[model samples]
Target: MKHQTSQLEFSRPLQVDRVPRLGSVEKLSAEPKELKALAKRMKLPALHALSAELRATPWRGGGLKVEGHLTADIEQVSVISLEAFRETVSLPVSRYFLPAGAVNDNDQEDDADPISNGWVDLGEVVAEILALDLDPYPRKPGEAFEEHVEIEAEPKPESPFAVLARRKGD
Candidate 1:
């Protein structure tokens, strides 16, 4: 397949097959517009900056080893305070992207990540990584969380032994 970058503002598609035998390294940064769109897609308050430095090393068998770090400044609502706060997110990424169906049964491989159509969309991958790394229940600095415990109103029912005792007394 002839690999090509998409027209989207945040597109970071890499043509793995086109890389020279020596391998390739890439640095990607998202513009303000792209960050805004990403924030909207991820349901965050705001996304100030998004950048990554990635290295792609190809093996003789067409498998690629991808290593990178993604950094971003984002604004999100704190679950504890219910207020917006800015925080920096940094994630180190590493994965193996094998060519489709390249693994043999005896190889005992993990195919969680794979190259598709000779291309890898670094932007999408970074976004997903950031989302996965985010705190599902974020809390602001110094925000206290108080868990409310409900107490049942009814008293405990009498046990069989207690009923038998009452009958014997009567």
Candidate 2:
């Protein structure tokens, strides 16, 4: 299918409270320009493709569970070789999003990091996940650091005794 570019920003927000069904599914693919802009925002070398399939379900009384899968092809600069190379990023999105101030600060948990405010933007989440999953120091396949230290040969310093003997002979 011919992919059409979208005007939506990478952080496009979706109001979950406006959904018509309890089990709603949204499939989204980033336009090439959007992906390129997102990559630029993320400081990535390049972005070839980005797409996702997300599902929203009510959970834990008032909270919502946003789950999805993000697949992307990107290019990054290798920290070791200093060359650019392509990579594939695939991340499973699973997180419970609660309205801001719904939970007390003391009750927060690591795994249940909730979304702030009343909206959940799958686009922003996907971008964040992609950024997190990317290698901070990407290196090309089979690229390894090889340290090459050069040693310069120099004449050994003359001993004090040898200097003294030369002075006495003089």
Candidate 3:
């Protein structure tokens, strides 16, 4: 269902049937138009570049394992400065794909899923990784965050339960 509702503007599906006995390697690079669409979908200020080198090998019971490394140049708005800044990110990628109805003993591998239409979208994998790796509150170096919130100097009143307990103790 995730693939059906996919808003991923960038996609490069690795065909399951094409993988050989040893393994297969693929290098994916995003085009300019794809980068623009992906940035919009991912809610980023800009995604300048995205590329990955992936290796696909056979796994347990007709499943497939894809491992790769991706590099991206991105622009984000700093949470403190609120100004756009650019950063280069490098990340290691790993994912498992099971054929539909195949059994998986490793329950902890919840991210594993069946291939969509006999293929795995490598671009989606990279995009998801980038999304997770992006800093939620990005700040440029030396841009310190100052807490504008002021704490109450006066002590708070005791709760009713605490007061009652104190009275009982007395």
- The top-ranked prediction according to lDDT is 3
Best by TM-score: 1
> How high a TM-score does candidate 1 get?
0.82
lDDT by residue for model 2 (73-142), tens = 9998988878999988788988777766666667756345465455677787788888888877789988
Between candidates 1 and 3, the one scoring higher on lDDT is 3
lDDT of candidate 3 over 57-126, digit per residue (tens) = 9777577898989999999898887899998999999988888766356666556878776778888888
Question: Per-model C-alpha lDDT, please?
Answer: 0.81, 0.77, 0.84
Query: What RMSD does each model have against the real structure?
Result: 3.0, 7.0, 5.7
List where candidate 1 sits over 4 angstroms from the true fold: 1-9, 101-108, 164-170
Tell me the TM-score of each prediction against the true structure: 0.82, 0.73, 0.80
Steric collisions counted per model: 0, 0, 0
**Cα lDDT of model 1 by residue, 1-170, tens digit:** 45566555477888778766777888989998999888888788999999999888886477777788999998989997799999998899886777767755566656446678888787777887887888878888788768888887899888999999999999
lDDT of 2 at 141: 84
- In angstroms, give how far residue 9 of model 1 lies from its true place: 6.3
Ranking according to lDDT, highest score first: 3, 1, 2
Candidate 3 residues lying further than 4 Å off, grouped into runs, are 1-7, 103-106, 109-111, 155-170
lDDT for model 2: 0.77
